[model samples]
Target: MPLPDIKPGRLSACQYADNFSDAHPPLTHVQALIEAERCYYCFDAPCINACPTGIDIPSFIRRISEDNLRGAAKAILEANVFGGMCARVCPTEVLCEQACVRNTNEDKPVEIGLLQRHATDAYFGSPGAPMFKRAESTGKRVAVVGAGPAGLSCAHRAAMLGHEVTLFESRTKPGGLNEYGLASYKTVDGFAQKEIEWLLSVGGIEIRYGQSLGQQVVLNGLQAQYDAVFLGIGLGGVNALGLASETAPGVGNAIEFIAGLRQAGDYATVPVGRRVVVIGGGMTAVDAAVQSRKLGAQEVTIVYRRDQPRMPASNYEQEWAQHNGVTIRTWSVLKALDTTLGHVQGATFAEVHDINGRLEMTGKHWELAADNVLKAIGQTLLLADPTATTLALRSGRIAVDDEGRTSWEKVWAGGDCSFGGRDLTVEAVEHGKIAAYSIDRALGFARHDTASKRTRPTPA
Candidate 1:
């Protein structure tokens, strides 16, 4: 039994810089113009219908075609405040671009995501006043918990509607998963922080960091003081692999590893094993495996219990991992970890098959050598004593209506912590936006005509 060989400086400085560079570079002006023109601008665009945030796809593309970059950005930002980040991280291949009409005649769908990045990046790169201004103060205060996409989106919308907002974030910085969970290559050059600063520019929104629910702030206190409360506290609990060797030194949560890589100032100093094994099929698993390879891991493997089609991550993401020299082994369920001196040396997995409609494990088993194992099965809601809030839970998540209203009055929830919809960032933004409007109506404020005018299309 010996300690696992895990240390930093595995990759050279130049390799680190190259490995972590932006995954998709922004398009030039000429390139954007050419791409925008490719859009047929269908009368009833299916692309818009497919988007979770319901951005006006054809209209924005038309604006870009006309050289109206500001208007295009306004169209995108007004629909989803975090459109820029979504453009970078969202799986447009299966969402918007999948529904694109051009995909029929031309195998290539219009680069809607790249065009979006072009427009939004243009606006943020230029010197101009903020897109929206705060309305006359309503004198009513609102307390928002969580600084992730949902919370930030809610805070921005509430502030724009003339409510004073106190955004409470448990973490030291805002942006929630955007700041912490994403792969370093997807969001480069601290874009998450930059977007946060831009979002806070609308005024009337004050951020209080290090304020977590149940500890520094409580639901009862917020209810008593603020006019309303919105909870976007995203899932904070990681699901375990349920193996005895999970406690091995080389085994860790994939989310924690991604967060550590995101926060590291020196990429070369971030320790990574020579051979890494990630277990799960979601984007988090793919991200961890790909980034491990980028960090100079000689071999990286993603083992998913189910078949590839059943994986939560899109096909595009799966292919991206394969292209990055990571291996995908499906229909394999982790059985146990082979550890040496409290360090993971390898993992044993059992073959799985779908019998009728049920998944059953076969007696056949195999093992793969690995110095590190990452568990990315899923995340669970981290509530601070559920009884204290008295909000009804459905399947271990906060139950909310179409308007993002919880069972309890004056308290609302959205994002991954709430039931309904996919856990995509764009979907979370829509939840926050809808919840803010609902909160406004509950407070008896005259609904801003713009709010109704910019309504999102119902999810299909």
Candidate 2:
């Protein structure tokens, strides 16, 4: 049977709006003070240690306690130019708040993300003052590819050093995945573009839309013309499910699906499914499944080949999905698709078990009556120009040294496409920031080896 007229429901709209609304609303004056007071303000705060950007967490919170919002905002933006977005998207329960000293004694840790958002929002409400300004022009130009978190961070930092930055983005707009890849509800209120506008307001940065890294733009020409180059090109390709699947009406990639939903001004018109099966166990899978259920899917299930412990979605995310009525099925892999009348009708799965460190699909299989199937297994790295360049690789990613310097000198890569990308926007911002510092020092504008300065132990 072919499913018809599946779209977001009114109840789903209500629930999605609630779940995806700004994760942390700006704290009220009293709320910020109370949260700041909870902080011990330790000499060496573990919360700072836990953050990838290493924002002076304690100092900012103390400033908030003192009602110095502008100072707090400056402290944050100094370390992370995208502090507002990070405050909205970062997994605070696992990072900063997890390391709070109060967490050891009291179950409730200070609301660090909220406090940070409160401070940063206050600054963005009026960005004309420009919390930080650039040094004198260095007469050096950098070509930054991709305007995502990493590219934007690198571009902003490079601009701060008085270096000219021309950012190339493939899409019509900026914000990369933050604008397109994220769940729409998480970034409601057009905050992603708003933050990007604010970040660029610092000056020294120029963006050219519809210019891709390799397809439309040439890398060699960029390398020859620019004084330095930062490749924050994110993963552009979506991984296949490896099934003999058809390009039917109901088969889709979770990333593109989520991107469509995020970009849609009218969520009610977005097509959904009556019964949707999302394959994989990562955050993407959970998000797709939960969102499908919210989008009027009568039955939504997540199928993963591995056990729950090996699932990539964090416990908080998994729980959030389950709380929203998403069913999780482990130890199963999508085997084949069932289609009818130019539309997807269902899918087949094989039972799998990890034996001798390898996943094996047993002979046993089952059928699922899914009107739509989404593949959320993972993403693939589409090198903008795969044939022309010979970029080194570490574990199937662009190999980079400590400073995000790729094997090809003068061609630095960061963000998801680069090796060691944790696939989080916050981590990507850190990558771009570090790469900017490294590029600055390499240009002889800075004194020290920026790459050698360790913020934390090398991540394994």
Candidate 3:
């Protein structure tokens, strides 16, 4: 049966299987051991410092060398409960691997990402051990909106602190972007859900699916009912290309396209165009274009409004998309769409150049025959009701103090919706963790109880 939205691809189902499988498989025990031994084990490991969650790299790798995988996982999860997912998506080349001492000598760094995955997998595969025990009931409750990396981290840490937690997710399935926005190739075998399940297993965290912050539930109600509220609702609205003909058939947002693929049980039925064109210079664009090619699109092209160096996607990821047979055209801006039968058939583009630091078309124009076009430009923040709260805003994002507290007291915000933070999952996790600690401290100080931070280790 043909899917109404998708065109048949050239590859067989088996080929799709190979292409969509995990981008980097976890290291085997021997491989992990060999790689762990390569670590110079610097007293102050730069890899650990590079990590956003700050997991003790040298300590965890040392435990792995000793074949104590559980200990290593505990160390990792202690810092970042979402290390497993981070291992799959983090740009190690820009983060940990780049800081490895070996990179200075041989240009080949220790496989830190794979090593982290191995440790986390070992613990996940084994029987449950109480890595964290819930604190005594604090008679406090926290409400978290959105079940993405940041929301889950905040909820879990809050629960561990003995505060009841309720996570409201707008999506039917929890695990926000992890369950939706990520590339299927990076997250195989439905690992996103598995991580969600593991995180919820910590207890005292209740999840309400299909519950949105502003629709089913209101932010003010949560603030009134719960002792504190954390908002981690990620960017909900896809940024429009400002180009005409966006609503035509065969046109979609890259985030939505990936989300559909992420939720689909069968990739073959996911509609892909024969000639797909993606517009953007970010990871979403690369993901959308590469997945299009993997789904058997004969020709997939990514058009960016700026040069390749200006692309937000990492160089490693850009090269990976190219290797996957996705053509990348930079310094080009989409002008308009050519449609037939009410569906997009091609697109016109203009050569773009910087004029006085502003982008301007140079009048050079061309058109590509595109059966479909995905807009991966980016996303925008959608507040249920902006006027309902006193939340400060900087450039349309929720402005927060250093502690992740918004202008509204007892209400905190983090993740992509909050200003002054990276949108990466790891950074989101950090934001949530920091916010959790801030909330915990505020509550702690009120009761005249001085406990260590909710997530991080006690200071010297």
Candidate 4:
């Protein structure tokens, strides 16, 4: 009854600064050169294949070694418009760095992610002519829904190919997860918006904030006005514990908590519990638990149903949470919430066993005392909305072809909202890029020959 012990100023200003400061600092000029020289510049770079966007890793690193940060960043942004954000948030340990030829026991990886940040930071710090140049106007218009990474990537690509793009975003600011869902320490100094500004400098694209799909912006209206439509509206439904009536004060979703923390004016003003228990094992779960600790939570535990190796969060992320004093309680699923006076008091977890890839709950259960319990199980596509009835779905998401063509010929979907998506920011950027090129081809605008023109064609 004492308001659940959630209060502001849990930590001093100095503690807040140190806790939320940049998780990975940028490389100095000499350090960038030293690291860049580590790359062998393979003729067939495995890092490029491992990358979702297929960035020219060797070329960029070579440019970095030559002290051409501008050229290096141009090479990166050409492939991925969100190069800076991806450099910070992407799990290089499992992706590019893992594929590095130099990632041997004898020698460490070339620090590709940091070198990338070095190049992008240099370009962003010193403004110059836009890296991207728009092609001749095709006079075709495209509608891009969601201003997150996928939507922004699609809009930027479509615009660069000379198609007018109208991007619709539900939130006040763009960058979707990059701006709202990412951990604060990862992307410090408002870098998300800075990258977006550089991406927009390519021209021929307009962003309409507060315009969400299935609401202010509808597919039927978009289809009628635009030659093609791209939907990157990410998953909107957060999964919950099977236990019903678990809703109570001091209990909430981890994504919501993260968004609040990202937007908070000051970390000291953010409310946190003395004890926090996070549900799930993916990136969001770790982010929630770790950030809770940073917010001065005395104790934080991550409750996951699966074993440690089976956790969706990368090894680096799990180690990060553990290093920050968060206890990883594996093979435990939330059975129920212990509430007092309509507020959460603690949680009950049932031990689970993996029997041939299936989680079987054991008869035994245990309890953990906590005031804040955050749900980070997973996210589901927003199909409950009546507006999405016309869209055919697969595996609980919007179905799309290799080129991002949806069931509707004129409509293309990508990012977390579509099936076959890897749920990685880099992969989402690839989806948008592929969809834009496909849309351009359908519009009869040849990339090589702008003189050719034909009406939008129906899918074969």
Q: Which sections of candidate 4 miss by over 4 Å? A: 105-107, 384-387, 448-460
lDDT of 4 at 145: 92
Instruction: Please report, in order, the local distance difference test score of every candidate based on alpha carbons.
Output: 0.90, 0.83, 0.85, 0.88
Q: How close is candidate 4 to the true structure, as a TM-score?
A: 0.95
Model 2 residue 120 lDDT score = 86
Q: Write the residue-wise lDDT of candidate 2 on 311-384 in tens digits.
A: 88878888877887888898988888877556778888899899998989888999888777888988877876
Q: lDDT of candidate 2?
A: 0.83
**Any runs in candidate 3 off by more than 4 Å, and if so which?**
1-10, 386-389, 445-460
Q: Assess every candidate by TM-score.
A: 0.97, 0.94, 0.94, 0.95
Q: Candidate 3 on 1-460: residue-level lDDT in tens? A: 2222456555788998898988887898999999999998898788887887888898999999999999999989988999889989998888899999999988899999999999998887773767788888888889999899889988988888788998998888888888888999898877888888888888999989889777889877888988999999999988997867889888899998998988888887887888999999899999999989889898999999999988989999899999989999988999889765578888999998998889998989999988889999889888876434566887788887766788887998888888876588887887788788778888873431211222222111
Regarding TM-score, does 2 or 4 come out ahead?
4
Query: Which of the numbered candidates is closest to the native, going by highest lDDT?
Result: 1
What residue runs in model 2 are displaced by over 4 Å at the alpha carbon? 1-20, 386-388, 447-450, 455-460
Clashes of 3: 1
RMSD of 4: 4.0
- Sort the predicted structures by TM-score, highest score first: 1, 4, 3, 2
